[model samples]
Target chain A: MADTLNPPGQVPVTVLTGYLGAGKTTLLNRILSENHGRKYAVVINEFGELGVDNDLVVDTDEEVFEMNNGCICCTVRGDLIRIVNGLMKRRDKFDGIIIETTGLANPAPVAQTFFVDDTVKEKTRLDAIITVVDAKHLPQRLIDSAEAEEQIAFADVIVLNKVDLVSPDELAEVEAQIRRINKYAKIHHATKGNVSITELLDQGAFDLNRVLVHAPDFLTSDEHEHNDEIRSMSFEAEQPIDAERFNAWIGALLAEKGGDMLRTKGILSYEGDDRRFAFQAVHMMADGDFIGPWKDGEKRVSRIVFIGRNLNRPQLRRGFESCQVA
Target chain B: MSETADKVLQTRGKTRELDAFVVKASFDRSGSACAFALGDGEVAILRQGADDWQRIRAHEGAVLALATDAAPQGWISGGDDGRFYRIQPDGTVALIAPFGMRWVENVTSFTDGARTRLVACSAGKKLAVFNAQDEELKVFEHPSTVTGMVFDGKGKRVAASHYDGASVWLVASRSDTPRRLEWKGSHIGITMSPDGDNVVTSMQENSLHGWRLSDNQHMRMTGYPSKTQALSFTRSGKWLASSGADSVVLWPFFGGGPMGKPPTELAGGDGINCTYVACHPKDDLVAAGFADGLVVIADIASARILPVAGPGRGPISTLAWSPDGAHLALGSESGFAAMVDLSKK
Candidate 1:
């Protein structure tokens, strides 16, 4: 079969997010000016504008189409669909795109835009969400705004910028705090928002490997637990799940509780099949694909990660555990 | 002669997989060639070379929209690759312009004798108007991303549909402010009535909204089961046809307007939604493609339905009738394309 469902050639989009004054612009300037030969179309809001003195990079304003759904997420989604769809129409425009969100903006709406819109879903892939964190002030900022924690939870890569301002022990404590909020993200330390541009771009942060590595023991047990409302949980099984049942359960689960799910991802071992089923969901929108078969001597395990507020871990665990083949 | 033309009827001819999941199809002025916007970011030109249609693959990514140009007698296509291209009947492709990674969501062409203009919109909420020589004429900034665009009768003005409403701009004039027509929801697809009396937009809320140009009277055409993606006005401007449900909904544009009167349904039922609709250029006939990939032509006067093509690879995304009404071209989401001769022998 020629695979009727052929994935269209999609442009990769990387989102830059952090609270106000977290060195996001400094990092953005570095990424743009760094001798990385790749050309990028940077999408940035003008309110918290970067004082980018470099003539090397130019930032332009883009109005995200507003959706009248009475939901913040849907509103962001409408603009993204139009903007992304519009950007995809031109040829040789850029190798990739970078979107810088407002300081107070929630990354969920921006990330969910990729998954929900049919046009955006077809033409652009969400590469990664890089959240720049102010190491010295994160503790106070976390208490000041929920968006601070939301950014931490949704980020695939957390740039702990301004590390020079914090003591070594304080840096370690901040790292530990971020881990407690989001155990899946890869953390990097930076002083002036200066980090490896290569490492940040094309990171495939949402790929199967990262999801598998972070949540392997998630289903087995919980350690380094946090009492915060926003947390991560895992569900795993050694045996394969009934594909139909699993899909039905997940579909209903997302339909009912998707708003509370900041992020959800999983790799499953299907019943009677060697092909591994890897899937991920940003809120309600979910995408799954069949990866390669299980390697020799590799454990046949399925694992899932959910990061969000008021996550009913016990209910989700029980529901996922019930999906195993009888 | 009428009977002969009617007997010639609608018949499927020459199905090709030159590309995949066609989003739009267009036929040039003479009907000698047809162009298809493939979902895989490629434009396939089927030229009438010698005996049969020869396929030519035209772009690098999924072609989002396609427009037919009459003067140069070719087709223009915009793709996800952020490039606009003009493909001639001879299969020669020219890069019209590039939008630097912005998806050219829509491309529309207007021609007045030797004067030609190509207007395209990109992701940054900007509209770039170009002359025939591909020179930038004017760039219009919008409050939101544009959803759809349509040209007026004289090809002098263009209306762009967006989040809140639509904007009507006189492309031929500079310093003329585009007449902004406001409504409340996100408008997806837009069309101007043939007589230029009103503008109607397909809303995201599974309904249709319209505004009379003369008085800006807001007209609501609601009660649809799905979002109306395609809209067409009859040649006489008596009816406006839309695709949203199993049947083609024809709103009467006669009398005072489509407000007080009820809409007439045609060529539908069987649980298959009409995915696209195209009115014949010179007749009261309309061709509608169903979600099942079936294409049928219906005469509004006689209420007769003739199956043009069907059981296709996927849902029909686009249907275009040549300017002279000599041929009808249809393309589906699964890369299936066919051109049917509609003229009398």
Candidate 2:
């Protein structure tokens, strides 16, 4: 059977999320008004956020529904599935799609919709989750709202807008806080949401090939303050991992603590295997495959990162270390 | 592929290559004409013997829904342009309701004696009902955006599927409360058994959920490989034919309502997923369209399969049987459409 009902090529969908007044609307206006020489169907949560002159702007309700498959964290955006299906009928009219989520919404359901729906998965690829943060008020928002922390934790690209509002010391502190929550996101500083559209769209951030490329220091063990409810933890092992042991350990770990683990990504070198195994997870759902053969003369290092709440760093490290071949 | 089926398409079929995706095709009540609603906001109508299709620019955007209008002998269509329109056989389009920004997602009509009632739902919670004269009768509110709507056999009650469940309402009832059949999932499509005893909904999940209206008993039909997008009740209401699995998944609706019985799969096993299914209006046969663009007719009793047209250009998107069961109309996502005159065979 064909894996997708769609034709060969899949349209890329970039999810835009941020707290209210974090320059999300400004960024959207810029994307729509700028002569990017591309047609994009933008799905926004509010209708009058900006006077966007684009012909394909769609207002959507943030209707989230838990899947009937008994996985609690496997919720999906019902409205988005409907809108995306409708937009696909006019697939030729748009080069790509961008979804602007509500400020207070959880980005997990929006991200999981691309993973859960077979039709959505086949028709559109989740290019990246771009989260915009107000550099001035992010510290207060992170302290008050869990959604703020989550938007940062789940982001593949973070646009620190309103950078001029904060001092250099304050900016560094805010960036540190963001790093403590999500170590791998590509952070771009912007003023008035004036970042290049290239950084936002078609990043292929979810692609396994680009997974570790964004995090150059992915394999390095860096010390950072981990005081927040949601923080990042990483582990590196020099020895090649046992495929069976690694699968069992990761599977059980995700099953038990996946809800608390907002995002998990790893590139591993398995013992006696020529190809590197790339693994990714959004809550309880996980996907992995042997991406390609390891490059010649490259060090065989297996690294994993988990960004979530109440992460038992020591326990997770022991579990991953135990997967190493004797 | 059967030779007879191949011959049917070769000799009796009228094919057209359109400019945009064919969203839906429907035969009129007289079975003398069929109209195809396209993604390019146009309606193409072909008379029983016409060599060319009379095209009408019906809406400003893609037509999202289309259904046969019985009393007027035309078609009622709703489009993303937010307009409800009626297209006559002469290629004249009349605007019925203009909902400025909301996409009219579904449209249906039913006749009672001489009056034709038009029903349409937009992207939100309202389902509007209008009379044959194009005057609004009543507006029914749903808990969420109405995804699918169908009138019962008697035309007295209308059932709408939306998020979390389906709702059945008495059309003329002054009371605002509808009989809500609660299910905890997104119900994207709905169908009513010919006898109006069962209301089944195709869910966002890869399964179908149904309710026996008399006692509110739940009937869960699972195990589909993909989401069931098309559903049809056999003429006698004995079987509910659905597309999603490799074969036509026919769940028995007559024998105590398919609660414990396994479905009888037909015309598949070749691993090609069926994308659409249309039951014969007057017989125990089903025409199924597959992902590989193959169309086949399967007899429920004999399990005999006959190929019709494809392996065309794209997966079949829509299928409709003439009210007389003499003609079958089908279209694919790649804009290939055909009407097969089974009557001559």
Candidate 3:
């Protein structure tokens, strides 16, 4: 089961993140203590100073540092590249890696490292970005800092921790708040980071089927829209899109609005094609491939979800509709 | 300068009409021929003739790995199709091993006197060794999936680099225990010195780690701006040239070893980082490819660099010196290739 889930040759890397006091350490400790029959190399902040129970705990002292002013993308990534690579040299040491980013840290640069670097890309696959939100304070934290909102937007799975501290209605409100920024991320309710090991690992959130399965109506929900500048816009088309036209439109759109577009994903049904085209974009980079043929009884449809700022829903809708096979 | 350029023979442009992403390049034993694996699972083998290369549909998917065949005239390649094959200089291909549906990560073959052994690593954490007859010899399982593999100089042993370190296995007999060279970290590339006295690995952490075979003494070479993806040792094993920064750093492996000796930095500046390097099979000259898609040949004693390939293709992905040291074959990520003949100079 350990090697079956992840493709052979490449190791799965899980980015574990949470705002301050959201029980990230507790979740990390739980992942470490669980008898999951797997080894994890945990990269925590100031690991050398803190005594963690894990045998393979690596202390990374903010390896990502700013090299220039106003450029949020300067973290050397070479540090994590070094650690992940160093961990790779001892191939027998661990099965997977868990990188726990700091509370205030934005996960964008970290995620970009996996995409931008070739050496890191060959040996490791980013399994998922798991964000553990402080259920009690996330409401205000989202408004207080952009870092918190960015983390929620980039997450593949959101663990709303400390549910006991908030009422059920409050919990629903927090869930609604998270949905406004990222409707694609799988959300789980937890009181003390008590979540199943299966929910965290081997979650092919990056896979098109698994991504679209959990959030079937993500792009259609209007009530969950957030007031903050960040918003999630989901779109669906009943008719299949002309693959070439759709590609050109998206390419031009990302080129013009990529700076504001945080993350975009879609499972598109194309004309003259039985297989579904699964696409995802991070900033300016986008990649898509055919997943599989639509089931015999399944309805053919195209759905897309974008999380970003100042999104002109009407304009984007018109642009996507124009790509339909004409 | 133009007169000097006229002395070196250069063949440029795409080997085939179709665009491809060149994954790797290799030279046969005599250095008279070369092979380049494409992203679409096809291979283009070029002989000594002028632009004499033909494309072969080598696999069903992208061909990711290629190694010089144990024989003197062919190559061994593995693909994402989960199959490994042996391609002769004449375009003849044979399946060496099949691994159900797993991607074949790497393949390396070595010739020991009369016997030739071909080893292939699959995505399923298994290494299958085959004899010259192409019969399966033995399959060894690793704690993790193997990243890279190489055969020692004598062809008696093969080392497979994986999670913790590398495992050195004896190909002649199955009873011998694989000596585990443990240096904790992800080791992507592995190479054994020509003399078989030292084995070094290019770590995921922008550095290199080596071991002296006799006493298992560890050698650490660190502090690079980027991850070192390419490594090459001189014919005499006196120097180890690696790519990590704008230039190639050649570490002195003689006398007191690379321990405290200051490395000789060659052909670096601006923002261009070396992506691959290859030492002449018989000379002190080394060929280095940069991230800017340029290939330069550097002389050890003279410290002079000659531009063999120009910029504008893509990052140079692979470089290899022909056996006679007369030609240097270079490939780029953009599926372009060029061969520079040094004999004319």
Candidate 4:
């Protein structure tokens, strides 16, 4: 009953995306149930271009036709901006916002909507993007749908979800593959859609200025063909990783077979301070710098995701573990 | 055809276009005939046996099919949407009936004695009959999506074809007791002979058929390696012609007429778009409308190309010369109609 971070005029917009049947809605419902009277405006999707039985598929008791709680469920109708703007008119009633886009819905235009639309951007800031992945079906889905690959590429926080469904071997394979596609995204291994709310919001992954400075793109002027089998695996090492040995291993891997690596990223573990350092790589081109210390009093563990083709997980694990401060 | 392998490519005309917007099956001082294009969204009167052009923007949503009588008043066209409009030579447009649907698949006319009527069907799934006077004669329903439709000789009966099956119905009554011709094949082109006694159908699959409406007796004309795109009955019903797999296969009635010849082998022959081939009602002038917007009028005896000039910026949708044999009208996919003065060029 107190005016919190989201007061009358300063609520942030968070985008939710994942592959089809990837537990996005389940996680959202859990959040809503856990934090009810907290008052967050919600955007839910209906059918999209790829649905066979394309009809409205949301199960909220709230009458969407006369929606008044800042909650807007837009069906296949192209009235997204209209619905969101209506909610913004009564902004005093809500705390923040969450947009549940369709599984295959491309998030670029959704992200751009925050900057492009004149009315809503004035009232709210884009907060964070949380993507859920079906741990069991991701491997096959990545091969079948282009939307899946893009979902991984644009993730801010990827929930490697549905861990209960995948076997131990399959879970390991899925985690390694996720890291290969996105190096900077914070990965959270989740089961039954369980994750800490503190971890979900305000991590500042949506801060474009901060990201560009810490990670430099080597192939900025050149076109890079994607290595089909190589995947990017990214992690954040809370402590310093042995930069000399890790660089040697990455250099040797690229020298003999850089074409086999699609991408890789991590926060380097420095030799002394128990603080996270960051890095990103695209194929053989790699450049990174230490941004700032990870927030003190936070869990001091390194987090990273590697994304590339034919990623050597055994060698990468051994190589990363070998970089521990001795 | 079992499957529709239609490759529609956009093309250009030399000066303008070779096409028709609305084709009415109409009547004039000439006789019982069909008008192909519309004028100012009105009527384009084409008599059965004359070559002159009549300007009559006489309908709404453009003309689809025209009818004719000795006065040449018998004709109908199921419009672009779903409304079926009828046109009289005096430039009078009447709404015969509305199918209350989405797409008007086809509206073709055939003469039955002195009382000629037009056959109109829309949404490719509903059928109806309107007389020369715009009278609603009968209406029927088709089982599946309609691909091709035609009225048999005399206009006493109709033949409807779909992606699954084909049927023949008597026009006298809105009868569903159609002689269920067992040849259940996906058809691309369907036609009733001038006498409306036999139905000729073409498929995208690999063969063409001739079913005798009398008892469903039929003939299978073979040889196409790919798909048969066009099929038609010669004016006299003495010859049956088909083009698919890039070759013209003419099946002569009785036993034999001529062994089919490839289009490339025609005298002065070049590759043709081969959209629809229409045989002249009066003579042996066979005009094949192509995707290149070229209407090649081939004299079967010479096997040569006689390019009839017309209008279009794309492929010809359907091409038909005035029944009187005066002006040739070419219909294009771009929704414009082109009329070529046969005597002009």
Candidate 5:
């Protein structure tokens, strides 16, 4: 990730994506009219075109511009590039660009804009990709729609908005689905956009360092085979991971067949002492973190998750628990 | 809980972004024990005790294993570089032996026990033994990754637990076969009672096992809500404490006899799992680190938690008391190793 100099000059792109009826626009209105002074140039593909009632969540301005292209991932991606490029040309005209995508856009292609495209990425960096999901409908969406799947898959941050209507069990299901799609994204539950908008913008999200640290277990390179039911599970134990056995076990597990591992993250704790150890893994890469000393009254626990289609829970559980002093 | 923490350590040379290099490994004490292994088959040791600690080039290639022997002043280290070294009191690291292996991960030194022994295990099944003098005494092969190894009381027998299974191998004497204690499935933790009569282990099988070494019988402790990791025994070996799911469980060790139900229990922080448990070497006081960074010390007798705060908010990884049992040394995932002296701090 490139460093920002003028920082304010760096364009902020807000991605609104989530399962249907996720109150994304309700949240967007708050971002647009919030007491903040920063000037924002809004980009919405289906903003007014969708014909949803404006009565529910009011828009900041009727100065809405629609994209002729389809979803943000396909046609509007280039259009987004051109629009952002043209806007940046004007001096201090717009401080940032906030784009709201249809609930179905796979953010990968949209995210690829900053990394792949040369011109638009250079002028305007991705600020935040926000996804709003229907708290009540998450379970059905996960069980039904592929678009709803991608909406969560590529979220920079997630807002599980409209918690007043959904039950705790439903919320848990929604969260589980979100975690299943993208485990690294930080999800904050909110009752509308009642949450603070300060955390929304200028967060420097397209920042890969923190995201990468969160997802040491993401295996992007290896493609999944036919089977898909096998989900990668994670287990964290606050016990001292016999360092020697852990390294060897992970190395061999990856060496023998990392392609099948899916992903794993472990915050490890050892016996006889109080410290937390963090470890993560993808197909070929594995790393660790000695976060610091464990807090007072804190238990030494290592939380590990392994995601994959054909994950052998029995085998993984055995290997994972074996990490301690045993 | 610091007003501010200075960057006491960093890489000698900057190569890439600081965030990506989040300092994965960290160890510190009033000793020269912190080290990193290089892929070039060598290792560099940095003394965390001294501020201006000089870097000591150790091993030929990627340093694989390191340990502070029973003597807190001296150190023993091994590496994939095929060389081992011993740091004497004079600040000199002398090459002690050669072990040509892919990599060695841990060095378990129990040289002070009645039958002194040093054991090291590598990435695969490579296991080697050494005398107190650092001589290679023996080598054996295992089927899976050998993750856990420890010397039972008096160091008469050496037991190594595996990722898939667990076993106890006798050291000092050569011809006797290792007494086998099998806990199939994802087995994570293992600990022996001070009397060397009972053993407690955490399993990935969603259960815990208590084995009586005297009779070779075992009892599976169940009803855990989730995965548990920490296990410890009282100095007298009468009380066995195992923390798991959401509480610290205490079961009497009657030479692996039937533990129909736990005799005592210590409740954990709400919603946070108790991950590790350390019984005071000489007392019934127990420490448990939780998932949310709550380190609660509980009384095994009263089942009341004493406020022996943990090291940091991060998951506490290791909690070691000084030989005198006055100071609690804590290690963490964030590269913070702290010594909380009961008398001083």
Candidate 6:
């Protein structure tokens, strides 16, 4: 019976995902070898990939299992649940945990595990989902593998590695393709995975309060050709939303189409309320809260983003518009 | 209740600060000594009236699992350093098996007749069984990593629970196949009744799954708010006490099993979860340790609870009753170890 009011401190967990030959091993080695002054217990699919050695390295079998609750999209990494539990027993030995998934891993199950397992949720926080992409081959990967597209769609930070191998124009094209699939991820250009450790760790990217931080060019209007079936759609409404209607509409939408929705996020200004509402979801599992009251004179605009496959822009727009307070 | 618990700790309890997370504590069969496996890779042994515990560095890493050795005088421990060891009462350690880099997740031992003793330890997907002569008898493989292992009452069979099911194998049989009890989810821990008629597992989900060996009948126990990490059966094998909910949930195992009856809840409703439970060796009493560091012993006949220790520091990680049912040894994750002499009460 951990005291809910004053629970123990949670260790941050970072999940590293990438395609084959994307220089993930390079980044992992840097994290482990550099004098960052942080002790991280790394959980990798195999040992000996990194040239640098760590004191606490654990091997995991990417064992995924469906939940018994009948939710088709609520699959979780069973191995992670076990490993995290074991690691927490030795919590004093490490500062953080880093999990490196296999190239073919579905990031959804790994992400969903932090939400579904009670022990994991209480002991560790999902810091961020960092996906490494090959700048020279991302365009081809997007076309050839659905996993590649899904990885981009679920990332909070995209490491655009191997920028030196591709032409300037080709790099811009690859960046645009990544943006089309995921507009919220912060894109970092690096060669040989030489990104700053600060940018990748402790991002708090999954925190509801950090959701919907729109960049200057985040809402840029574009009518680009479709290169992949997966894409991102964003919506903004100036009028305050009826909370009840919006809840009903979003509930029904997620229930029917959550399998197609990889990730969703929003910050809303509800009718007759001064506080801001933050919402996020992975498939059908949704979480939300009133983060805080609006700043002194800030504009109370509501914004939402959905990264998924086969999105119906017009139908979603209509459903959103109908929730506005009339 | 809090005042009474404090008085009990002050009058009848002897406390020790081990300066490490206490993983598991058990008493030897003769009730002469108790051993505690610690996170700092050491095993501490305290005899019945010893003023201080003797510490032995048994492994190079945290001792993940510990059990009283089948030999009447020592303890067996498994460590994250991938080694299994036997610790003598006099602070001597012996390496029993070396698993290189894989963790020795669990260990259990049982004595058969007068001379034959069996020791079993699981490392990942393989379970290695050794005999009294320290000879590797057999290696059992499971479909997935074995989370829990236990021997039946007769020590002729052992059940290993893993993902999806629990497999019961005859300890001495040469056959590769075992009697499988199939379920759908991950089974994290397992226990068997003394009568050997039931095999129960604590699932990764907040529930318990049990199977009657007679027909492989499934008895699903649901509605636990958290994962049931601890489960124990009374001496008569009539009730199964578990930790998961706010209370000590005791499921009746005598009247046609706990298949359709409601479990009796005790010493709870305070918004605190019970983390570990140990039943008295010869009585219907059960000692339950809470997540808030409270220990309460409940009487089954009168439905009364006597608080044995007050809440503080950290959650209780292990609890065990001495063979004579007169002493209770408990430890918390914050290194608090206490031996309570309940015989005087």
Give candidates' CA RMSD values in order. Answer: 7.4, 3.2, 15.9, 18.5, 22.9, 3.3
Tens-digit per-residue lDDT, B33-113, candidate 3: 888887777888878865667889998757778888877788998876678899987888988878765557688877763
lDDT score for residue B190 of model 5: 68
lDDT of 2 by residue, A1-326 (tens): 11221234899888899998898988988887889899998887654366566788776678888898878889989888888887777778889998888899889999888778888888887778999999999999998999999999999899999999999999999999999788888899999999999888878663433545456554645344345478877677889999899889989988887888898878788898997777778998877667667779988888887889888766888899999999
The DockQ-based CAPRI class assigned to model 4 is incorrect
Give the per-residue Cα lDDT of candidate 3 at A231.
Answer: 79
Ranking of all candidate structures by their TM-score, best first = 2, 6, 1, 3, 4, 5
lDDT per residue for candidate 6 within A1-326, as digits (tens), equals: 11111123888888999988888889888778778898998888754355437888777677787778767898888888878877776778888998888877789999889778888988887778999999998888888888888888999899999999999999999998998788788899999999999888877664433445554334454444334377777777889999999999999999998998899878788999998787778898776667567789998888888888777877777788788998
What range of 10 consecutive residues in model 2 chain A has the weakest lDDT sum?
A: A1-10
**lDDT tens per residue, model 6, B1-345:** 567776777788888988888999988777889999898888888899877888888877688899988898788989888898888767789889898777788999999648879989998888889999778998999988889999998889999998888999998898978898999988999999999989999987799999998886889999999999899999999889999989999999967759889998999889999999988988899999999999999997788998889998489999999989999999999899988888864
Output the lDDT of residue B65, model 1.
Answer: 75
Q: For model 3, what share of native contacts is present?
A: 0.00
Off by over 4 Å in 3: A1-326, B1-18, B116-124
Query: lDDT tens digits, residues A1-326, model 3?
Result: 22122246677889988788888888888878899999987777653323567766665545443322222433334357645644543344568888898898878667766754566777787878899999999989988889899899989899999999999899889999998788778898987789998999876555644565656664453343334477767677888999999999999998887767888878788998898777777776566667667779888878888888878877888888888887
lDDT of 4 by residue, A32-97 (tens): 667545667666643432322211122111111211112122111112333353344334455777
Fnat scores for every prediction: 0.16, 0.37, 0.00, 0.00, 0.00, 0.18
Better of 1 and 2 by TM-score: 2
- Any runs in candidate 2 off by more than 4 Å, and if so which? A1-8, A207-228, A237-244, A269-277, A289-301, A324-326, B1-5
Candidate 6 residue pairs that clash: none
TM-score of each candidate structure, all chains considered together: 0.69, 0.94, 0.58, 0.46, 0.44, 0.93
Candidate 5, residue B206: the lDDT equals: 50
Query: Against the unseen true structure, what C-alpha lDDT does each candidate score?
Result: 0.76, 0.85, 0.76, 0.55, 0.56, 0.85
Please state the CAPRI-style docking class of candidate 1: incorrect
Greater DockQ among 5 and 6 belongs to: 6
Best by DockQ: 2
Model 5 TM-score is 0.44
Model 2 gets an lDDT of: 0.85
